[model samples]
Target: MNSVLINGITMTYDDTGGGSDSAGSVLLLVHGHPFDRTMWRPQQGAAPGHRVVTPDLRGYGGTQVVPGLTPLSTFAADLAGLLDHLGVRRAVLCGLSMGGQIVLEFHRLFPDRVAGLVLADTFAQGETEQGRKERNDRADRLLRDGMSGYAHEVLDSMVSPATVADRPEVAAHVLGMMLAAPPEGAAAALRGRAERPDYTATLPTVAVPTLVVVGSDDVFTPVADAVFLHDRIPGSRLAVIEGAGHLPNLERPAAFNDALAGLLATVRESARDGADMTES
Candidate 1:
């Protein structure tokens, strides 16, 4: 894990040193609402040779929050700044839920900087203005009420029943992470979600290699949402992680990692073929 300043926000991040073939491109993992970069650790550990960059996101983890800045578009700009700071020319993006929204927004802002995309448990369009406000209101309430008060209720929606019963530690770890979030962090994430752009219109515009993955039992972002993204994003592939829920990376780490590795392979192969075509 490391730190860098982007858009005046001190962003905290971790990079998995890529394997032999990971040099030319990087994998940037964006976490969901209320979750820090640690959410991607299980998947990062499983995928070797891929330079994985996990940012705690503004207002999450150790990231220094920028005051007076609001709106979700700034978050996308923040990502572009991070890539510039790291000297990443172009990279593959793997983001979950809120993280997925970040990628979509970034693509709109910095399309040329992205090599490919992997959207997991995410959506392009959701939340009416009222829905957004209600969610934000609840998050504020939880932050004030102590995360533990809501953590138990959230677990059922986060992980599959099997994981909760079979992998209690997994649930506990996720719960702990949620509980540790500061009130400001939680509020900032809620605000970001509220201001997220409707990316459904941009789906067909994404021309890079792509993958849309989700757990079969993801209640927050259902399977239908993944299917919608797959059908809309030109040339993108879709994978349904079985026996998993919202947090598949934690609940089914192996499968999540494998899906990521596969997305990388597709991107690499595409790049290689494009080079050959240019040479010819």
Candidate 2:
């Protein structure tokens, strides 16, 4: 566990020291909304040959939450600052759900710093008017009733029925993460998320290699969303983890890690090819 001051907020992150003997090839893992860096524990030590970093986004985990709506751009900038502070010039950015939107914003703002992208269980569309209203309503409810009730309410939707019945431990873990989240921070994020721009126009412009992953049973962001991304992002690969839900990385770590490992290999190969072209 490490902390850095980014944009005047203390951001908490974990870095598994440069996992490879190579250079400028870190894997930055960004967690989803209402969840902290702990969600990435299943992936820790999984990327043996590449440095893997998991950071708690502002207002989650040990990080300090800023008052008011913190836009996705702010989250992107904070990540850029964290990379700068770590002396990393470029990295493969992997994000899930809201984290995926933040990655898109990061690519929009600092494309040069991104080597590749892994978007899991997330979509490129912004919230519709009804979606915005629903999020606001949920935010208000969270502020009023608190995390305990809200966590339980969303658990079924977040994970599959199989997970809830067969994997009680995983369900408990997810609930715990949600319950521990700061209500104000969650509310602020919901509001900020409601305003996120649609990435439909931006996806076609993504020049880097991308991997679109989804759980077969993901109710929030279904496999259809993954297909949408795979079709839009040039040369992107799509991997669907069967019998899993939104948080496939946690529910089925082995399958998710395998997909990630494949993406990392593609990224490395692409980098090598570019370097060869440069020398030629």
Candidate 3:
């Protein structure tokens, strides 16, 4: 893990260390709530000849844990700061769930810095009153009971029943991530997430090549949400991984990687077209 001073904290990340500034050159993977950079380990080498950077958000993994609310905007800003620190001018951002929302926020705030976008198992709409209450209540419960019970309860939902039955190792990895997450960090994230703004308007404005992916069985943010995103984002591609759940990248890494590979190919083609036009 590479540590850097970004946005006043010692942010930690994994960087593959070398790649050019060409299309699909830099891939930044953002992990979702209650998980850290290691969640992206399977994807680090998926994109050959690219720099794959995975970072732990403010309160997760090896990063400094600030025991208070940390907004999505703050997370986005930390990513931008990290890019600056690494001398990267632009990157293709890939995120899942809460991480996807943070990627949207990053695009909203720093559109010029985004070369492409990959949003998986996430929705664009803001929270409803009931949803907000549930998240806050969950936050309180986590602070009170810690993560063990919550991790146990959510395990089946995070992955699918089939995954737990057949892929015990993947299930264990998911559970381990949840159990290892700092309660304070997870609580603050829940509180902040409860206040998230709708990215409904942000989708249509995406000018870069985008890919919207979801597990067909995702209960948190279903395949319908991915279709909704695909419908809104002009020229975006939608991929539904069959038989997987919220975390398809983990439940079905091969399919997810194939979808991502397709997106990277599209991005490269677009870049080449642009360069040819400039050269002409």
lDDT score at residue 155, model 3, on the 0-100 scale? 88
- lDDT tens readout by residue for model 3, 188-254: 9999999999999888899999999999889989888999899999999999999899999999999
| Model 2 lDDT per residue over 75-120, tens place | 9999999988988889999999999999999999999888999999
Show model 1 residue runs off by greater than 4 Å. 19-24, 66-70
Q: In candidate 2, which residue ranges exceed 4 Å CA deviation? A: 20-24
Candidate 1 achieves a global lDDT of 0.82
Question: What is the C-alpha RMSD, rounded to one decimal, of candidate 2?
Answer: 1.3
Window of ten residues with lowest summed lDDT in model 2 = 16-25
Cα-based TM-score, every candidate? 0.94, 0.97, 0.98
Error of 3 at 2 (Å): 0.9
Candidate numbers sorted by TM-score from highest down: 3, 2, 1
Worst 10 residues of 3 by lDDT: 16-25
Local accuracy by lDDT, each model: 0.82, 0.90, 0.92
Question: Which candidate's lDDT is highest?
Answer: 3
Q: lDDT value for candidate 3?
A: 0.92
Task: List clash counts for every candidate, in order.
Answer: 2, 0, 0
> Which candidate wins on TM-score?
3
